[model samples]
Target chain A: GENVGLHLPTLSVQEGDNSIINCAYSNSASDYFIWYKQESGKGPQFIIDIRSNMDKRQGQRVTVLLNKTVKHLSLQIAATQPGDSAVYFCAEISDSSYKLIFGSGTRLLVRP
Target chain B: GAGVSQSPSNKVTEKGKDVELRCDPISGHTALYWYRQRLGQGLEFLIYFQGNSAPDKSGLPSDRFSAERTGESVSTLTIQRTQQEDSAVYLCASSRRPSGNSPLHFGNGTRLTVT
Candidate 1:
């Protein structure tokens, strides 16, 4: 019954612009969150992750923000590039189990 | 050469046939997971294996599905009497620990199509 959801099914952004994708999760008990990127014909690749104890985490060019009060999570990509075109997914893992539930992906299309 | 590995990247078979998908986790990873991704849908958890503990099969859809793992090694998911609805990408992922906090490393899935 753990359901993680995305706010949008797709997003379009011009190359070099910033892109933001949002996700909503139902489990308040979940303590860990991760963002992944999947390219055509490839599996999901880990981009960044954050613990519930922290509100935000940053990686090379991606940032993950978690809002426990609203049960919302978002991923921001800076200076989006054409190579960044892919489906993005947010996953959650609760303290009770090792299973990581994934949300429906948001496809990001970057126009060069 | 250091990531999860899956075999038979693609497979096609008749509806009545049986198919097995294989997953090889990273060298020292102890947690392995199997998930199904249907067209236009999110990944559906199928099974999980950790160290020497009993595998958690809660996510399996039916009795037609079965999976095996030996001592944190390779895993095989077998589907008996596969149906057309079984057509999907079977994704396998592995994590270094069973702490439920580590991020997972996924392998390109095996795309199965039951005609």
Candidate 2:
């Protein structure tokens, strides 16, 4: 079955440091990728997204890099903050369907 | 102006009982989605509705899980003969379109606990 998985289940980073979370997807037909942040007792919040046509996309203090050859995706957060600590999930959208398949999620713990 | 909203922020039911979760998408949004999140897990795609067209229920786990949407507005997910494994946070999200660029806005989700 097609699936998306993260390299780490949890990552701890110090405040003011850059943090990177990695994901690998199996489906070659997937064309769209997104990153979501979910806080305790809250729903997942969309952060940034990238299309197959582009290898990278940047948002406020956040960047998403997509590597098609290796089927890898990464989210980089600059100057990690305590409020940024949450469960981060990477989702992939197949070209044949609009359904979004989410990864296991990586918990980011920012040490202040 | 409001994001997606869901009913019964928390639900406590017993095994073999049936439960209904409701989702109200943002105004004028044509796409609605339902996802399940188990404890310490990621989101599980369940079902999706796009306008008046036939719903894409392919992601539904089993026949025990069912969902319906009226037009492009509200949707209801009904779990029949729920089991302990059904305990999880049921989330509803809505997007402007079914494309990849359109980001989904999610509701707080209904936390269900089957005893």
TM-score of each: 0.94, 0.93
What value does DockQ give for candidate 1?
0.44
The alpha-carbon lDDT assigned to residue B82 of candidate 2 equals 96
**Per-residue lDDT tens digits of candidate 1, residues A6-106?**
34388999999999999998799999999998876778899999999999998888899999999999999999999998889999988787889898889
**Model 2: lDDT of residue A109:** 90
Among incorrect, acceptable, medium and high, the docking class of model 1 is: acceptable
| Docking level for model 2 | acceptable
Candidate 2 local lDDT, B7-43, one digit each (tens): 9899999999999999999998898999998888788
Provide the lowest-lDDT 10-residue window in model 1 chain A: A1-10
Q: Write the per-residue lDDT of candidate 1 for residues B48-86, one digit (tens) a residue.
A: 888745458989999999999878889999999999999
Write one digit per residue (lDDT tens) for candidate 2, span A1-112. Answer: 1111234388999999999999998788898999999887888899999999999999999999999999999999999999998889889996678798888889899999
Which runs of model 2 end up more than 4 angstroms from their true locations? A1-8, B52-54
